[model samples]
Target: MSATGAIPVPPGKAGKAGKERFDAAGRRVLLVCVAGGFTTLIDQSVLNTSIPALRESLHAQPAHLQWIVAGYSLAFGLALIPGGRLGDVRGRKWFFVGGLALFTVVSLLSATATEPWALVVSRLLQGAGAGLVNSQMIGTLQDVFQGQLRARALGMYAVTGGLAFALGPPVGGAVLAAVGPEYGWRLTFLLNVPFGLATLWLAARHLPRPRPSARDADLDLVGLLLVGALTLALMLPFVQPPGWAGWLGFAVAAALLLGALAWWQRRFARAGGHPLIHPALTRSAPYALGTAVAMAQFGSSLAAGLVLAMFLQDGLGLSPLGAALVALPSAVAMGFASAVAWRVVARFGRRTVTAGMTGSALTMLTGGLVALWAPAGPLPWLLALLQLLGGASIGLMGASNQAFVLRHAPAEAAGVSGAILQMAQRIAAAVSISALSGVYLRATGGGGGHRAAFAWASGVCAAVAALAVLASVLAGRATAREEAAREESALAVTSNEPARESTRASG
Candidate 1:
């Protein structure tokens, strides 16, 4: 109905105006989400290079140091699924705010802690908070964006995460250099405080209110418990690698827990409840293949990063700061590549993923050859150049792979799907980094030289990357086959329609 003497706007123009307004709002929201993601991810690795400083400052034992690293990750992996479900059921706005507030408070506590136990506990609580906020961030992106915009938004998200990981070491090293060891480590925790508070404010102002769930919504507690336990079982050995005997025990426990989880999910769904992970998601070919690709690439790529840092410091005798600087190109290139990755995805579909994985594999293999034979004077420069390409390759693979996998998630279960995909990547990084470290250490200890160790580790990463390439290829072929089948069915229906109409007319 129009007001008297006023004309009604054309429907198409009105719709375009509405869509433009919505998109502007979504972009503002995305900035807040990406900031939250960047904060937590940077914290994940920022402490690694500062471990020595922490040990000296806190008077910590080796065991305490180990816990300081392992505990945070343990809590993070445990919290993801449950946290995601909470956001799904409850509103994301309050949950995201509460989580960020918790993270901020805990960061302050960590900075002030005088005892090792206090710091350890603070880290655990902080990880839980981060896990909670991160789930909502991923969930919000899933809710707010669609089509190519969704892919591009997720690409930016990936860029931040990758950049955070790569930059953490350098960031920490710089802080330590700026301040003496006595205070350097404390400042790292303190750094999160200001950024967290700012992001929390933006989130409170800009994030959307969550839609209410049904009054009878079920959380599937049993499924949540199973998931948490299974995650611990699968992750513990990798984070703190054990003897072969202990490894066997954890592996067996993980397998049994997994079976139990699958059974429970199905039974719960049959009984008219929502499973934490939908059965259809587990059965989805695209999801399965995409996950495999993510795990392989994420684990191996991170392993290569860790190994490269070591090679620079140990193999090349560069200082920590120097090593970090040499590796900076890779991180910078990753962000650059991620910024434009969606354009390639628009053109190539899954082939973009395949191309990226192929590039990564080549980069790793080339790194190995260069490490073994490059002149000492030029080695660092040459390796840094290669790493630049490596980072871009990863950016392309990660952004495309994440968008593809998450799109397959049912709208109702988007949070769970994103959590699961991230979970796989985290677990894979733990295992692969541990395994690759052993390879490097073994070679170095046996007098095989750091050059050989770098070569060996790079070879392993390249092999895993090749596996990712294979998985991406298979996934793309499956999609093509499904599209062809759908087209054939549609054409058949159209061709038969005219004949059926004539017969009806004659009758």
Candidate 2:
């Protein structure tokens, strides 16, 4: 026995035991994280398919109808940073289970919603719960796995997310069709109940509880409040009726809220308590640039879907079922792409990012041109091609950017870093959808001019893709620097290690 009241074992045997324990823990953590991700998929996809049914049943107007979707998205985005911080401050297991419980309860409430407002509020709560669970997943993975294994786990995580996105719409539609509209939308939300309960039970029984590290800090409540206020202000314009006064008020609030939030974060950081986002992490070139790319890519993809769905239904006179079928190829492509993202990243590094973004930009530009010149001709094939191209691009850029961010983040700050990235993405999605919807509304003369609206929406996609290209360029440079630093560190460590002969002789 060692002096510290511990038993010392043979080095080989100890290493074997530790390895076995680590492998077991890693598998358990992966299972829990993947389960959480699956639920999030259900929540997101179910709502998307049920939007029309929700509108019909609740008698929701266009502006109000957007809330059915945007409400959940907004809440989910706003809560991400705080959720991550909570996981860091508390333990991951509690946050994970607590989030799942909140989600399950809210999902039930959503299923029971008879009024539009009831559904909206329930969706928001559901989003909040999802935010808590999702923001902790990457951090939990980092805590459980390391090196190549971590990369593989992340790849699998991406694959799971892709599968959820790909399957969500069709499944939601199938459930709705089977049960009838009265029960269809409700089932989408209610379906999450069993899955959530199962996750909670399995996690409690099998997941290893991680101890709070000494390095963990207290929650940054002030920073969190400020950021939350800023996000809410930004999303308010999208949800409210459009008027000059309303727009102006929201703009002013957003500016003030963001300014105050920035100042408070700086103040908090200087005061010794951790800020909601670690300044050092955000200040890193890779982190900052990677976040920008992530935001634009995800935001643009979501906006494209929203706008395209509208165009298909209104302009092409396609049914919701028909449009979803047309869109299936892209979604399927995205799923396949996610599965292979690890191989792509390992082979091409950041070049994969640049290429993907460039491809997306070209695809959007081409789609817009084609739609404008030939709106009625070859509609299905044109859309099919566009979706395939877009899906491939999203798969490459989305997973690659995530890997890039994780590679650069310090292990301890993974939670907060992921939170910030997700925050940017949410804000971007909210703002883009609002702005694009406005553009489509104006172009179509308030929903009557479908052709013009589709053209305008295509234009927005092009602009977003262009912005992504710029982000890709910056990401490329940052990746180069990171690779150089890694090489230098490796060399330094190798130089400092004792000679092999000397080590062997001493042993």
Candidate 3:
């Protein structure tokens, strides 16, 4: 057994046998991870659709109800880094199976939940399990596939996840409607049991048992605590009553926690110990910049969708079903666009990213203008068109951005690199949602507010689009530099090899 707990085969049979075993393990891991993702999607989507039912049944206030949703996100976001590190240290297959088991049990408990708090706790546990599953997925992929094959597999993984996000709500709604309110919400949680069990069984039977490498480092418990604290502090304002005091407290707490985390990581690096995120990779311009762009893009996209849903239901007085129908265009566009994203990236290189971001910016600007100027006017199909355009742009840019980041990252830092990106995205989403929600509430005059909330949301969308454009420009420059460097390095190697061979012949 290797220090990392990976089983070492005899040299003669190692190459061929390892390849065969890895191939089998990859499929099983992928199945289980994807199944977990589906359940997470179902949990989020079903809750959103059944919120009204839940409120009526439990007599819950808006604040309490929001917690039901926010609890899951909070847990999921906070656990990501720790979970990824656990996979790195303890071996992925076990963590993957354990995560699924936890998810399944909690899901069953959630279905039987009688009160809001009970469901909220269950959702938190489910989210933690989801975090474990997601964090290890890409690491498993890396372990199983290599080079171009890896890229293709990762692309497919992204596509599957995008489709799940797009389809979740509609599927949840359909199931809920069919079963009625009494059984609908319960069905959402219970739906995972069969798939989870199947994944667990497959994993147990077919997954390779990775030898635990004693060389694996201990978990950075302090770093994990700080990260969890920082995340919670950042998200607190969103869940609590909005006030200067609440916001100020959250900000201070977040700043302290983040500052401590940074210090701890630096200390660990100086001591030659492995940190949760490697300092070298974290400090690299490509990783840092790519992570920033990803954060802003993901944050803005999620905020826009949530705000749009609110506008459709509260501002326009549309039914939940009507709002969902209106939002379908963007979801459909995202799903289809992601499949062809790799082709677009290859053809245009970084220019494609710039163009996509430009398109997104224009769409957001147009949507904002329409919202502000034609508040009560004719329902322009422009909203749908703009959404489609924005979705496609995001789909194209996101896939390429991920590839570029991973391509530049050092091999040993893969798990940390992935975790950093994921963390940025989660933090961005949480902040954007809170900020945008506040803006919407202020613009419209609270829960029973005005149509102006839509206008404000439109403005926020436009700002995000502008940021996307800037990110595209910066990312393009970085990609060009990277490509040029690669070419120069190849040329140098080619030139040196011939000279060395000639010297040897002469001698």
Candidate 4:
């Protein structure tokens, strides 16, 4: 290892075994880092099955319920960019350890909260910590692996995330059924503490601290506030039914904040100051379009899960355990698909994402039809089939979209790029869930009838899938162009190197 803390690869055949050993070490570090991400996703999904329990126990209003869920997501999304940028400047390991510590403490707080409002605050803090931890994970991966190893590591990361999300409902349901709702849901939060501590130990032992680059800039405090306010303004109306006045106030404030953020970023860039995210990175066609596609996929996928859960529990009168069992096929399929995603991407490149989105759209449309007309006796079977398709779609798209967006990103900017990608995803999940919940509640009128609501949510999922298809296609084109340009540039440099060396020798 270099004095700067970078792992130097040995040259030629003599160093081959050393390189292999280094690669193995990197994989271990990746697993440790991904554990944090897995835990975060579990935290998000485990709460789903427990929502009814929370309402009954806490006497929570609909608004309170929404906040309890959306609060975590909003804080997570809001903090990611700044968190990632902060990691870039101050060291990801430091930020990661601090974030894990905070998350563990808040998990305990969430488990102990007796009031709905108290739980909401705890969830927000927990998500803030999750954001900080997650912001650094991909950067850590980028730091350790290269070439084909990097691709496989990223695919594994995606697989872990998918499994965590898929496992949450079943795990949460089992707990709720086994221990009873009052205490079981609380145990879900408490479960993170030990896992977090173990992961922290591994990270401290395994993670390398590379020297920070000169380009690492100060944390954009003003930009952070602007983004936080912007996200809040945009997301608030979804969670709480804002009246006309409230909507107007939020809209005006959102516009003003957005404009202010843009102005500040441009001014900072012109002054040779680093913004939270470099303006160029945002403008890059492949990255921007890939981010949109990822957002759409995440939104639709999360909403679909919620709607399916409702369909099973309410529309068909299944117990939470039964519902979880019926949903298991999707998770299984997702795991299978994730395992092979890298191979598919290697051969087909961005077309894999386009194909995945297309499949997702078809699945949602099919699911919606089934929800509208299929008999309850056949509902479980049909939903399983649909989930199989949906899970496969998500598994195929998740890692590919992430890798595509960051493929052209500068090494130093990996943290910020990853932060933006994940922030968009979490934002999409929170907003879509809020909108779908509103639709479900309004459609059912707080009753057992949820067919109409399920169909509506399915339609929205279909629309999101369609958007993803468009974005993925455009992203594919942009990615191909970018790759080709990069190839040509590399050839130019390679072709000139020999000539330059020959000239020097003659001189």
Candidate 5:
């Protein structure tokens, strides 16, 4: 590493023709990564509209229904960090290919399931596969691109995810309408097969194989178990809340587990072991604050989206298709905004994140007011407009902020860094959904109706949005200080260069 903190480029690595060839190859690889992400993220939300059709077909019990939907997310979260670390130690190529293959095979398995229990198991495995693949995708981007080029690649990635999420409901609903109810939901799982296979083939051909590891990875069994248990402890209360006492117990367990994990990681490091997470990552102010930004944006945005879907269907009594159509404008706006976000980040840096957070907060507030005050005929249109603005804010924030956070990661630990960033978001998503939906559920049960429920939940989202903005500001300042320090050091070195030259001349 140089005094300026940049790793020096290798000799013969900067030739123009060679660089161009590498760039072209890297772009092809990027397309494969994005395609894989697009497939998995679509799976994340596609089942939302498939529940009714699913229940009717499988005659699934209430518990089965809950597991089918929530299990996927739970498994996805559980797989991220460990998978990322493993991909770092082992080559990413096999993991990416294996994970995608597993995902595809299981999608077919899910499509063939006659029993809900079988479907639940398959979905959980599928989520794990998706998690594995997704982590590699982020890590691969970090490995492949740098500087403004990285920002652009990640921007494309973030926007693709946003579009996948926004498209999930309508795509699922359209499938249901096209086919009869019985087979529609099954077919939804099958959608992944073709896409996954094509992407898998491309990945096998294009993904660069990094040099082999000198030694086998030291799989930290104890640390991995602790993290896994901690994730479950945190997620369960949100998914299957078992009264206030139970919730308190889980929270305490999570806290205790966190402390234990931290202690173990320190011990493991002192023993000269490669811990699952990099030690430097935990100490980073930039990482912590950037994580805060991602968590808030992901959690509140997803919860808000869920609330809108429920409000349209359960509250305003719109058809599934109708609700999806109303929500489509947000996706459209998000796609457009994300495509341009890297340019904004280039000009504005981290302030772009603050702007996005502020915009999100205001939009959430506006959405609440619209829910409470708009007439029935105009409610959907008005909410759609609100979502359009919200989507743009979210899109700009997601890509730029992701690039912002990952920028702080040490290259050697890039995989785990990306994993942890997303892992934080997943945990936040669980928490936000619990808090906001808990409020919504209580309000509706109290006969306050959908308007009151939405209004109260939106208030919670706005608070999270505020937190995101504050974090963004702090992160920006931290990054600025680091950059300023580097500049000063460089100037000091430059100032002594002439004196050194004069002494050499005299000698």
Candidate 6:
């Protein structure tokens, strides 16, 4: 009804107006969500450029340096599932704000820290906050968007991330070079302060608060502990240069803790309790396969970047800014590739991912060969070209992989799925960086073995890419079959519902 007590606007017009309003709201929400993630991404890139500067200024040991790089990732990976569950049980709004606030404070701590251990501890805490922030951002997206809108939002998420990757190196290098070596690394962390506050303001103003869960439901604290313990045990050996015996001990502990986590969560949920992450997610073939692929992609890529950074800065004597310039072309190509990724996914499905993995494998192999023999002057261009190809491979697969994983996840477990995806990536990153460092250290004999180190790292990346190809193929087949079964089941239920209702009314 109109205010004049006459016929309302046409039905089509009304719907169109409503849709436009909804879209406006969605866009604002998406910006807020992406902003939260942007801070973390910038922090990641800036820190990478500052690695050598930190080493020199703090007089940090090899182990200390590794912790500085890997600690936050380890902590973030461990906290993600539990943090997501907390948001599901509590309200996401407060959790998001809390996480951002914590992140800001810790960023300051990390920036101001005078000692190596202090910086490491602050980074660990910052990672935990980041895990919370990411879980909430993803959950918020799932809550607000549906169908085509959801797909677009997720694609935009990937694009924003790609842009961040492109921006990180140049931003870090510029800041580092401007501030000089002593204080440049600190500025990287400090830069997050304003962005964090602004994001928090937008989130509070625009994002809706998630409804709290039922009173009886809560996160499985014991399961979270077990998962955390398992993560810590698995990560410890990697960061600290633990030998074979130490690795064996930690591996055993990790296995035991993992088994315990599974058993506890199963029994808890059987008693009508909420598990940290639903066991059904584990049973989802698409999620499992996609997660494996994501792990490989992140691990190989992060390790490759770290190894290359080392080669450029330490081995080749290039300044941070110079190295960033050399790496700029790949990042630019990646941003462009990511912009069109959703279209590729819509058209090609899982085959696109397989192709990307194949490209990744070839590029890494080529990079390895180049590292071994290519001359210095033309070497940067060749490496840039290989990196550009590799970046495209990553952009093409990553968005689709995430979408596929989320598509199969239950609506109530949105937070869990997001956490699991991120956790895999971060864990892979932490472990891979450590492993690559070991390879570099051994190959260089404590000096300059840039070529050998790069060759070895690229080989590992190629192997991972090959495995990813197999995983993506298997997952695509499984997901197609699963979708078909679901459609049939839905149709069956729909057909039977009318007859059942008729029978009930007659009775």
TM-score per candidate, in order?
Answer: 0.85, 0.85, 0.84, 0.87, 0.86, 0.88
Across 346-456, the per-residue lDDT of candidate 3 in tens digits comes to 556656656766676677667767766664535335566777787787777776777766666776776577766776676676566666655665556455444556666
Q: Write the per-residue lDDT of candidate 6 for residues 1-507, one digit (tens) a residue.
A: 111111235767866644643467788899898998888766776687778888889888767777777777777777777677777777688898899899998999999989999998998899889888888887788788876677668767766766676677778778887888799889999998999989989989987866898764376779767866776686567556578888788988988998888889889989988887688888888788888888888777777776777677877778888877766776877877787876676466677778887898899889899988989888877887887888788778777777777777766666578777888788887877677765775567566567878798789888987898898888877877776787789899999999999999999
In candidate 4, stretches whose alpha carbon ends up further than 4 angstroms from where it belongs are 1-24, 209-217, 244-249, 410-412, 446-448, 483-507
List RMSD in Å for every model shown. 6.8, 7.4, 6.8, 5.6, 4.6, 6.6
CA error at residue 204 for candidate 5, angstroms = 3.3
Best-fitting candidate, scored by TM-score: 6
- Where in model 3 is the C-alpha error above 4 Å? 1-29, 179-183, 245-249, 361-365, 372-382, 438-450, 485-507
- lDDT at residue 219 of model 3 (Cα atoms): 67
Per-residue error at 19 for model 3, in Å? Answer: 17
What is candidate 2's lDDT per residue for 11-98, written digit by digit as tens?
A: 6785665464336767877888899888875577556666666767888766665666666667777777777766666678888888
- List the global CA lDDT of all models: 0.78, 0.73, 0.68, 0.78, 0.79, 0.78
Error of 3 at 292 (Å): 1.7
Report clash pairs, candidate 2. none
Q: Which of the two, 4 or 6, has more TM-score?
A: 6
What total of clashing residue pairs does each candidate reach?
A: 0, 0, 5, 0, 0, 0
Model 1's TM-score against the true structure: 0.85
Model 5 misplacement above 4 A: 1-24, 52-67, 112-117, 142-151, 180-182, 209-211, 434-448, 495-507
Q: After superposition, how far is residue 26 of candidate 3 from its true place, in Å?
A: 4.6
User: How far out, in Å, is residue 338 in model 5?
Assistant: 1.0
- In model 6, which runs have C-alpha deviations exceeding 4 angstroms? 1-22, 209-217, 445-448, 483-507
Error of 1 at 297 (Å): 2.1
lDDT of 3 at 248: 85
TM-score of model 6 relative to the true fold?
A: 0.88
Please, what's the RMSD in Å of model 4?
Answer: 5.6
